[model samples]
Target: MTVERRVGNEKIVELLEGVSRSQIIKQLRPVGDASSAQMNGGSDNVVASFKELIKRQDETIATLNHQIKNLTATWLHRKRFVKTLNEGIEAERELAKLKQEMAERCQIENDRKQAEQPHIEHFRSASLPAVAEQWQQYQIAQLPNAEEVVVQQLSAQVKQLEEQLTYGWQSFEVQGASLAQTSAQLVEANRKIHDLEVQLAAAMSNAATVEGARSQIRDELRKQALRMLDAMLRFLDFITLDAVACYTV
Candidate 1:
């Protein structure tokens, strides 16, 4: 099959003559290294390919219309098939997206529930000590000897709370140290991401420069091959519909 593209004549001829899997891989490597957006440019070659497909589709319809001139049924049948196929594909894609969204929402809810659990336990533990002390102290009997001796419970409670505060400060310091380490890791990760992005951009630019030169040669050869096919058909009156339909020419 002849390839039609917007590239140079001589370069097109050279590449087509020597095309290989490795050569194609060489063309693909740069796209792999490129940014998602820039790789899309390398992938524009795909969109360009679609242009030819669309053109050939038009040619096919023309041939069908010309050959089966009496019946409009075939034309309508082809149109309906293409429409139904496109619609089915679109519906499937939408359904997949909705499923993905629901999965993400469920995951977020699970995480929220997990996070609340720890705080719930902490509150229960804190309340248990105060309630127990209140109940037990009320049961203590008053001292004998006609006068009741009063005990200073509030001072002892205050001292115990101070000890707990000291430990709380210690726990806070340990968490603060962990946060400092995490911050350092985040900074390093950002630096690495930046470096990879820069390298990817450079690789893309280099690949584009190489492809530009290589594509020129491929175009020239494909265009000539197509022209030759057309010329051969013109010289002979036996013009087969296959050339117009399947043949790139």
Candidate 2:
């Protein structure tokens, strides 16, 4: 009876131990499963975070490239505008020189006419004495031949003066036409310069606006990257703690 009672007590202790071990295993199973799920969830979160960061970085790079392209185009346009402005200014200077040359030519022509006037008067004075002598002879003799010779000489002198005046007037008309054409060209150049200036101003304004947008986008990207890094760090910390806890268990 004593041995049998001892055996029955041993069986009861074994059954109790088995029940406690099973209960512990049941509790540990859920914990292990939960830890495993957390690890998997953390891995997924990290991967997603990295992917999102990569996507944002790519977008930022693309934005920077776009901004660079815009800046380059603006710079090229400005260079072209500057070149055009320089060319216009040079053309204006050339026109001014042409006008100065025309003025000098007019002054020279006037001086030449002034120099010739004295000689013309001297010739008229010298010829008048001869003409007076002829006229006196014709009056004294009352001869038709003497009167005819004096009349022919006077008509020739008048014809020569009329020819000189006609040539001077024609030259003046030609010079006037050339000056008018140059004035019209200068006015057109000025109009084109004004248009180019307006275009440059508009381009500068557009560049400023684009730069502002690029800066704003860069700031947003920086903020987003920082947020992603912080979340990744926190996730890593959570995984580390979980690993340590599992090891302890």
Candidate 3:
């Protein structure tokens, strides 16, 4: 059986044994008295003594029963107290575990924020201002007068190169005898073509550079937005954890 049941049974057995011993003592004393009374020819006194012994045994049984009741009540009270204490200890353990988890989460968030601090500063101090300046410059370059001037300059150079190349071919065809002069003109035309190509390539490279800058700006903006959202989420989590801790307390 269970430990409590076993202990209660042991106590009951001990009490019953005490009652049996007391009954045996009373019985023996009365029997001895009756034998002496009989020997003295006192039958009435023997009967009266037997009645008194019975009354005393009844009183003793009642007292023992009362003591058993009191002991049982005390045992039950102690059992309840111990159970309540154990439940309280378990609750304390659970609370401690929850608090530890909250602390760990808070530490992780703190570490993440610390790690991102440099990127945040860089975005604010360098990336943002640089993007703004580049955007302003791009806007200025897109103006009607400035665009037209650039286009016209490139077109004029192309046209001049084409005219020089046409003149050099015409000279070579019409003045075959003046080979050296024609050769010089052709060389000059080739040089103009190469210069024009170089200028075109440079323009294309500048356009690519501007595009790359814009892409970098966009990427930086995206990263900053994500960081802001993460920070807000972390703050909300911290507040929630704090509220939970307070409520648990």
Highest lDDT, which number?
2
As a TM-score, model 1 comes out at 0.26
Error of 1 at 34 (Å): 99
* Pairs in steric clash, model 1: 8-216, 9-220, 11-217, 11-218, 12-216, 12-217, 12-218, 12-219, 13-217
Task: Count backbone clashes in candidate 3.
Answer: 0
On TM-score, the candidate that comes out on top is 2
Clashes of each: 9, 0, 0
Better of 1 and 3 by lDDT: 3
TM for every model, in the order presented, reads: 0.26, 0.36, 0.35
Q: Candidate 1 clash total?
A: 9
Ranking by TM-score: 2, 3, 1
Question: Distance from true position, residue 230, model 2, in Å?
Answer: 99
Candidate 1 weakest lDDT stretch, 10 residues:
237-246
Off by over 4 Å in 2: 1-38, 124-249
**On residues 1-249, what C-alpha lDDT tens digit does candidate 3 reach at each position?**
111211245543643453445454554566565445443344344455556655666776777778888888999999999999999999999999999999999999999999999999988998888999889668768887877776777799899767766765564454444444445655665565566556555555677585665565556556655655565565556556545644453
Better of 2 and 3 by lDDT: 2
Q: RMSD to native for every prediction?
A: 50.2, 49.3, 28.0
Tens-place lDDT per residue, model 1, 139-207, is 444334212222455567677767766755665565557556555655665565465556555555776
